[model samples]
Target: MSNGYGKKSNSPILASVLHGPRDLRLEIRSVSDPAPHELQIAIKRTGLCGSDVAYYKNFRNGDLQAVAPLSLGHESAGVVVAMGESVQGFHIGQRVALEVGVPCDDCRTCQRGRYNLCAKMRFRSSAKSVPHYQGCLQERINHPAKWCHKIPSHVSLDSAALLEPLSVAIHAVRRSFIEQGDTVVVYGAGTVGLLVAAMAKLSGATTVLISDVDSGRVEYALHNGFATKGYINTKTSPLTELSDKLMAAKETAVDVVDIACADQPDAEGADVTFDCTGKEICIQAGLYTTRPGGQLVMVGMGTPIQTLPVSAAHLREIDIIGIFRYANTYATGIKILSSGVLPCLDNMVTHRFQGLDAVPKAFEVAGRTVDHEGSLVLKVVIET
Candidate 1:
C-alpha cells in the first residue's frame, strides 16, 4: 500500500525538527498526495503546548525520550487540500481539527471502546512511539479521514487548533461525573487548567474555584469568567512553614466559594476536585479539600512517582481517578467552542508567530513563564 502520500511535488514541505536538546531546525522534505483512506491537510494553526515545549528544551517528556530526530507538535487544525477516492465523509477545503492519536481498530482496547488505550496507537509528532510519528508542523499531512472532525464556521482555525487540549479538559470533567450544583476546585491556571475550569462551569458546576502559583493566571481566570474564584498559591515548602501556607491557599479557594453559597451547608467542601498541576503538594491539597465521598480527578502529568495520602483517602473514601490523554471527546469540545459560551477562550492565545521560520522563537516563548517584558503569556500559536 502506498503511504498515503501519492504523487511527489516539485517543492518540498518545510518541517520543524528537533535534532537534540535545545536543537531545533527547519528541514525540507518531500510529500505525496493522499492515498485510499487518507485526506491531505494543509496545517494552518498549531498550538505550542507544555509537552511540545518539554521535548524541545529537554528532548524528553516524562517517559518519552527523544532518541532520534523528531518533529514536535500535535495540537493543530487545518483544511483538507485533497482526499483519496475512497474517502467519503470529508471533502476538499473542509476545515477540521486533526485528532493525532490514530489507533488500531482491531485491538482489544479499541474493541472495548477505549481506542486511546489501543496498544498499537500511532500518534503524530510524538517521541513516545518509535520511528517518531511525525506531527503536523509541516505544510501538509495525509491523515485518516476518520480522525478529522469538521469545525463549525463560527469557530476560527486558532480555536479549532486548541480543541485537542480542550478535549483533555472535557474528558477530565466527564470522568468527574459532576452534578448540576456540585462545587468544583481545580489546581493550576495554565491552558489546560483554565479549560478545565471553564468545562466545569459549562458542565453545571455551581461554583468553580481555581488556584495557581502564578498570580497573573489566577487573576486572568477570575477576570475571564473561567472560575468563580481564583487563588494564587505562593507556598513551595513541603512541611516547614507549610501547614499555614497550604491552609491559607486552600481556604482562599474553598472558603470563598463556600462562604458565597452559605445557605447550602453541604457545599462546605468541593464535591469534585481536579489536580491540573500534578505536583505532589497540589495533589495532597486536593485530597484535603474534597468532601467525604467526593471525587478527586487527576488531569496533569508530572513526576511519574509521588507519595500519596493513602490513609486520608481511605478514611474519607475519596475516589481518586487518573485520566490519560483524552478519549472520545473531540465532538463535544468542538460543540462547546461553537456555542460561544466560553467567551474568553480566544483570549488565551496571547502570542502568535507565523510560519516555520518563527517555530524556534515560538517554542522559546512558550517554555517561559514570563515573556521578554516580564508579563505572563497564557498560550502561543504558530500560524502556517
Candidate 2:
C-alpha cells in the first residue's frame, strides 16, 4: 500500500460472504483504498457461474475445495471510484471488467502470452492458493489496474460482466482455428455453449449446431439464432462401461450429423466440434462427429480422468485442442459487446436479482434446472 491508500474510507462496505456450503451472510466491513497501480472499483454487476454454484452447494469445484470462508464471484463489472497516483491510462468513473486471474508476468507461459496457463496464477474467488484471494461479491474492491479492462461506454453492465465467460468462448474459438464456411458441432446449450456457438457463427462457421439434454435450452438457442439447428440429446444414457459409452457416442454422432445438413444427404461430420458439456459421452461424440483431420476443442472441464476414444482420434489424425479459461481476450470481448453484432447479447441474462442480499437466492436459482414457473434459467445477475 502507498500514496492515498493510507487514508481509510469512512463509509462501510457491504459484502455477501460465503462462510460454508449454502451459507452466505451479508457482512459490513471497512474499505481499503487502492494501492499504487490499483483502482478501487464499485462493483455494479456480478453473474453467477457454474463454478460458483459448485462451491456454494458442495463447498468445492472439482478437486479444489473451500476450507475457509470465501466470497464467490468472478464474472463481474464495476466503475472506477479511485486511482493511485502511479496508475495511468485510467481515470475515475470508467467502466471496467475485472480479469479475475493474476499471473506472474515473468513466467515463461506469461511471456508467451498464455498467462492463463501460468502455474503461479491466482484467480479471484478460487481456493487454489491459501488465504484465497477474495472475489467480487462485495460492494467495493481494490484490483491491479492492469487486470481491469475498460469497457465501452455504450455496453450494458450485465453484458460487461458476461465478458468473462464470453472471453472463454472467444479463446475456444481461437484455439479451433476455424476458417470461413466451416461446420461446427457444439455439445451443450448452456451459457458457455451458447456463447461458443454464437462466437463460432460470428467467426465464419457456415453451420453451427448446438445440442443439449434440455429442450427449453435448445429452443432458446434456436430462438436467439445462435444455432443453425438444435438437437435434443434424450437418448444418451450414462454408462459406466467404456465400450458401451463409445458405442452410444457413435450412435448419437450419426443421428446428430444426419440432421446437421438435412438436404445435403451426405454430410459426414462437422469441420470442428466443441465439447462444452465436459461429459465423457459428449467428448466421445465430439471425436465421432468431427471430420477426419478436423479439430475438437475441449472447452469445458470435467473429471480429471475419463475414458476417451483415443484410437479413433489417432487413426483420424484429428487434433484435440484444450482450453484453460482464456488468455488475451478481454479487449476483443469488449469490442464484440460494443459492436452489438450479436443482438441476443442483451437477452443472455435470463434472470435478475438485486442487491447483496439476493446473491444467495441468485445462486439457488442458478443451481436449479428451472425456476418455480418452469422458465429456463440462464445467467443470473446480481445488481448492486
Candidate 3:
C-alpha cells in the first residue's frame, strides 16, 4: 500500500520493533503523510534512554506491558519535511525536536496546567495504551505540529535529541525548588543524573555531588567537569558505607539529595531529596534522607505500585511529590542547548549505529554492555 507520501519505490525505510523480550526486529515500512495538525519529520538523531532499553530488554517498562509489536525510541530530533494543511507556525526543512508525549488538552489535569498527568496522554512507544503510539526510530514520522518545538539555529540535531532528557531534568530541578547555595547531591551518574547535576548547578546549587555504581560514569562526570565531587563505585559498597564516605569526605551533610540511582538506600540527612531513579527502594531512600518539612520529588518511572515509606514520611513531615513526564519546558530546553551552558554533547553520544538494520545490535549492546562513559544513539535516516 502506498504510504501517501508518494516517494519513489525501492527507497529504504527502517524501523525497530519488539516482538518479545530482547527481541528487536528491524524492518522497512511505508511512510505516511502528516494530518492537518501534524508535521512530517525526517528523523535524523534518536537517543537511547532507559525506557527504550526496558522495552527492548523486557518488552515492558514498569507497569506498562507491551502486548503487541511496538516501535522503540522517543528522544529524537529531525528536520521537518511536510506540513499538514492546518498546521501553522512551522515550515518544511525546519529543524525540530519532538516532545514525545502529547496530552489531550481537555482533561481537568491539562486545564490545571498539569497536562503531563492527563489521563488520555499519548506517549510514543508506550504500552500504557493499546495500539501503542509509534516512535521516531523510523525514516519519516508524522507528529502533532504543536508538540514539535523548533530548534535554535545554533543547536545541532545531536544535541537537540538531548532536549527530551534535559526536559526531564528541568522538571525535576523545578520541582525541587533549588535555591542558590543549597547543597545538592545526585544519586546516579547516568545521562539523566549528569543532566540533573548540571541543571541543579545552573539552578543555583552551590555544591553538587553525583554518585553511581559505575566508576566509569563517575570518571566521565569528573572529566567532563559535570560534577564537583564523585562517590566511589556503589555497586560493590553498601549504601550506609557510601553515605558515610560522602560525609567523611565533605565533612558535612548535603542539603538536598537527588536519587538518580535505579536502586535506593536509606538516606539519613538531607533537606530535599529527589527519587529520579523511580524504584521503590530509591523512593524509600528519598523519604529517609529528607529532613523535616523537606520535599521528595519522584521523577523516575518504575513499577506503578510499590511499598513506600509512608510512616517515615508522615513522621518527618516530608512531602512526596510525583512528576509525570515534563510540561512547558521544551522552549527552555532549546534555550539551554542554544546558550551553550551544558557541555560534552559529543562525549555523551558513545556509540552510533549506521541504519535501522543496526537497531537490534544497538539494543543488545546497550543492554549487555556496562559502558558508563558512552551512550548509544541509533541514527534513522533516508539512505543517502
- Predicted candidate 1 versus true structure: per-residue lDDT over 144-165, tens digit per residue: 9999999999899989999998
Task: Output the better candidate (1/3) by lDDT.
Answer: 1
Model 1 TM-score is 0.92
Model 3 TM-score, 2 decimals: 0.84
lDDT of 1 at 251: 56
RMSD (Cα, Å) for all candidates, in order, is: 2.8, 1.8, 5.8
lDDT of each: 0.84, 0.89, 0.73
lDDT tens digits by residue: candidate 2, 1-384:
444534565558998889888999999977766777788899999999889998999888889988888888999999998887789998788999999999989989999999999999999999897889889999998899999998877888998999999999999999987899888999999999999999999999988999999999989999988899889998755687777888889998998888886656567688899999888889999999998899999998888788898988999899999999999999999888888887556698889998999888899899976899999998899999
Point out where model 1 deviates above 4 Å.
1-11, 237-268
Which rank order by TM-score, best down to worst?
Answer: 2, 1, 3
Model 1 poorest 10 in a row by lDDT: 2-11
Error of 2 at 357 (Å): 1.2
Model 3: per-residue lDDT, tens digit, 1-384? Answer: 333445443345678777899787777877656677888888888888888889887888978889899988888889987777788898778999899898999978999988988889989988887879988888887898999999888887778888888898898888887778665666666778788888988888766667655677777877887777676433333445544543432322232233322123553455555565665555655566566777777777778877664777798788877777789999998888888888656467777777777787677666633535454222222111
Query: For candidate 3, which ten residues in a row score worst on lDDT?
Result: 375-384
